[model samples]
Target: MKLVLTQFKIELLRIFRNPYYVFWSLAMPIVFYFIFTRVISTGATDAVAWNKHYLMSMTSFSVMGSAIMTLGIRLVQERSQGWSTFMRITPLPGAIFFLGKMFGQMIMHLSSIICIFLAGYLISGVTMPVHLWIYCGLWILIASLPFLAVGTLVGCMKRVDTASGVSNALYLVMAILGGMWMPIDILPKLMQAIGKWLPSYRFGNGAWELVQGNPPKWEDILVLAGYFIVFMLISLYTRRRQEAI
Candidate 1:
């Protein structure tokens, strides 16, 4: 238990010291929210409604960005530094090591969510039932699992530079297609069709539904679960291969 806690703290320290992670995970999303919600108004009938919608979208975006991009890059760097190899030979269990990483990522994810939510409430004047806020936040965290899994897979398989390039490309493509940056309805018909199947779209959709006082669609939940399973399988396979080598 003490070792796990120590590993978790070390991971947290590493993340906090990385200016790139701090800026992208904590600052960028909040900035985007202000630009979209305040500078460029949607002019909807209910200001709160527009803010609420963007809140969910931005939250989804932030969660995906941190879970996939940051985590993937960090994992690749650790591997390149031979940290993974060292850990493998240590007395520490693999589960505990990964769990510590997950805990650190969870902290990043929750912090991103909170910052965006605060921006929505304070700057954009978003108002909702307290329970709705809690529900939406929980859904955002839950929906991030697939992306986290994908990050782990990418980290396990790619070198640091390659992982960074791939993760960034995936992040931008998913965000654009998933209606995180803009609404899917405005996109070309083909793109909208493609967006419907991406995990990022499903994630944002679930959060949006929750904000609208509706239950999340089971299809979205199931799709994300499927993605998580597939990514986990690939990650495990990659790890096993690396161990054998």
Candidate 2:
């Protein structure tokens, strides 16, 4: 148990020390939110709904970037560099590898929440419900599992460069198509239809629902949960095959 914790601690420290991780998980979201939200208020460009809407959407978008893209790419890179291979041979438990990745992703996401809160309160002047915060936090964590599984799969399946490239492009494209960067209502009808099929879109919309005081979304949650199981199973199956090879 202590050994697992130690491994997690080491990974956490390493994640924090990496500029790419820190910037993407910490600084980049703020920059995106601050600049775009501020620009939306200028009246030259129209926004989705209002200040609160911008707050909700941008926050969700940023969370996706941190947990999905930043963490995903890094994990893939680590795997490519023989990190996972060496760790696989270590006496340290395998669960530690997954757990450490989880902690790092979660910590990075905490930075997103802080920045969003700051943007909401300071810039947008939006007030949130106590229950809503709880809802978002729980749902966000739940949604993260699929992406975590994806990160693991990408790292396990491909070379680091390939995984990193694919993960980043996937995240960015999804962010745009999912209405994380723009309003889905304004997008082409085809884009709106396609976006619905994306996990990121569902994630952003789920978060948006809570902030908008919509009814609890059991269906969406279930979809994300299902994805988590499916992704994990696939990644695990593939890893076992690789080991055999």
Give the top-scoring candidate (TM-score). 1
lDDT of 1 by residue, 1-245 (tens): 79988989998998778888768876787888899888986666777777888889988998899899888888898889988879989999999999999999998888788888988889878988999999999999888999999999878755788898899999999999999998888899999999999999999999989988999999899999999999999998888887796
lDDT of 2 by residue, 168-206 (tens): 887889888878776677789999998877777777778
Every model's TM-score:
0.96, 0.87
Clashing pairs in 2: none
Candidate with best lDDT: 1
Clash tally for model 2: 0
